[model samples]
Target: MADDDDEGGFGGLYEDGHWIWDDISKSLVFVSDLPPKPVEAIQILAKAPTGTVEFRDDVDLIEQIRFRRRYQRKLKPGQEDVITVQDVKDIALYTAPVQIMSPLLINMLHLPTTERFIRALILYSAYYLQIADEMANRIMELEKKIRTPDCDILEHEFRDNLADLRLLVAKEYSVMLIGGSDMRKFHHMGPAKKRRSLSDKDARLFETLLRMCVQIVWLALGRKSFNQIELETNRIFKSEIFNAVEHTLKTGYINNMAKEERVVLLGHCLRYDKKLNTRSPLMNEVFCHRPIDYRMMGLGVIKVQQMSPRLHYMLQAVAGPEEKLSELGVVVGILGMPRSAFDTMLRPLPTAVEKSKASMSSTSGHSSSKSTASMGKSTTAAHKVYPDVVLPRKETRELFYPPSFPDEPEKIRPCSETQRRRWQNRLMKLLHPHR
Candidate 1:
């Protein structure tokens, strides 16, 4: 809202590639849409003994991108460093689509309306998860039930249900968010990531989902349940998933190369667990089935344990008198919480489980982060909704990264006049939908 002459202004927005930007106040500029949190442009500049951010307004085109960058200081006092950016000219002045969708507003890709949207998504997600949980359990039960009797008649009955279950499984999509990819070359590699074509919005979310798919598939493989359900994940990563990921990644910016890291690490997860190259003090590695990252959901069975002490009783009560207590172990295991509390209280009933497992659509499927902990959060929630929403993901090739600005640019805030017009065009569609 401030003027270009004012610290952090919009003058550059109105100008073409040829515009000067000097509206930087010493205060940290905050743009909710920008990733890894609002970068302290002044702080990054303060690190420079002779750092500066000035826009060059002498371009051949009208959309003279207003650019910004600086030399930086080291952790040690009085030490200065120049982080060399080879395409500094292009990068420093590029305002990108990733930048445009970085804000929470653009997150409304599927959430056309607000207040009801989140609750609706939560309800939708809860129901979806409930079904997934049921499907997983049914898959377990059916496998156990059918395997006990290897008669031809039982096999035929199982096959019929198997076809139906597969169709059910394919009805919905599950999302996963990988934090980063190993930018470093995987020479000691076997199969590479697959190059499944994805839009920028999808690029960010699907890649993570792809990584998770690899892990989940591996988990299923580990459990040795090869033929448990109906239509498998269409987007499920095969050996080609990694190839697709690596193939696309090699085409992106070096800084953005970490996407490959996530997929590669996932490949490693398929073969190894969390102990991919590094080992824990306990010599323990976390497996995909028991992802340490599952804590993000905040409302899963894991969190339920924190709320009560009688969950174990509930789970036990769910089993029929003929069923052993061990059968319901998965209900507790997938949650990774103290089962004695709530699950113990609301014993999972077979009929209830069967009802929840009934097939429902699942569209399961974000950007960068500063700290590793928050990275997935910024870029992931969209993937949380998965194949349903149409959002942008990082593409394999980005012809233009958004030009750098004095500070992080806000969502819908254009760095060049041309971009403003482009956004305007999009706004027009939203304002006047063709019904």
Candidate 2:
């Protein structure tokens, strides 16, 4: 860490209405006017200059031609102006694709560990939402401008803003590091005189937030997966199981293991997948099903994932098919497991897929075409694990990612009543946990 007066110092953490740190008292402070609530912050972001540019559905062929003509730039000194017929064709066919920032971390309102923590969480959410919204808006602007004469100028502006946005993101993360310190006093009213790094639990939360930022940035850059981003920020602290859960969300698998190796992997995934409400019977079945079952011991999958590396090495290849256990050593080295676990799961002759397939085959098809279509749907559904927690898809799409400009009246109102109720419930819990 740098000195308070220098660059990357504590001075950078202070913003008029976000956070402040008092040197004499050695305590971090929250500004009286914190950032807007999550939803309101999003609304604020959506009103930015570029944010107002929207996707339109009524652009005619003549309008596209006009747009293209406007974008034709004058050649500079020593520059060749080469416009091929293909270029014209491309301009005529171009249509902007609707891009969306992944909502997993953006919309999620976690239960803060302390009441004081809520302010920091909300502030961070505001910053994250701002950057995400700006990036999306800039993209839309670029799409529109690229077909007009001001394309070059607009591109320059977009580039400059992109750099500025990255800096804002860094400052946001810094505030989290500073804010996570314990600042409450004996009376719990004023600041404490002790300064320290974030606690273990708080550090985990910070790491999660950092990963979210990275994921969103990568998505905005048009990357399909966060693998590169995740690897780059690997040093950020997170429990292995939690890391696995994130990996599963981005990629449909846990660390690219083979089918047989997936038995334990899938089990861990099921245990850690945040989508499923834990009390569900399916969760119990997955917990008891085998390889890494922690039911009898009363331990959590996360605890096991973070256990001693030496213990994992011992249990790495205890049982299971030869092919699946081949890389089990490496898997165990990274994620520890219990002894006799793999052997227990291996005895079940048929895999989950085989069972599902057999059941489908047993049912005779009413018609060939219907059967074929049904099989395809079933197979796809079998693979896609729909999230148990359904977000306000309608609202998110309209506010954060409207599919079309001049959004229809029906599309704009009441994003999701369910989401509203859930957020209220979470807020109540955070504000009055004991109640």
Q: Give the clashing residue pairs of candidate 2, or none.
A: 55-405, 70-148, 70-149, 71-148, 71-149
TM-score of 2: 0.20
Candidate 2, residue 75: the lDDT equals: 38
Off by over 4 Å in 2: 1-162, 180-198, 213-223, 229-435
On lDDT, the candidate that comes out on top is 2
Q: Tens-digit lDDT track for model 1 on 98-137?
A: 2222221222221212111122222222222223332333
lDDT of 2 by residue, 1-435 (tens): 235776443443555567677654678777778456653122221211111222233567686565445432233486333321112212212222122211222232221112112222222222222223233333345546644556444433433322222222233233233442222221111234253432442333343444443433332222222343343233122333335434543543334433222332122223443543332222233234423312112111112333243224222212111233224432211012221221111111234335534544544221111101101111112221110111111111222323533311211111223333443454455447899
- Which ten-residue region of model 1 has the weakest summed lDDT? 365-374
* For model 2, the run of ten residues with the poorest summed lDDT: 384-393
**TM-scores for the candidates:** 0.20, 0.20
State the C-alpha lDDT per candidate: 0.25, 0.29
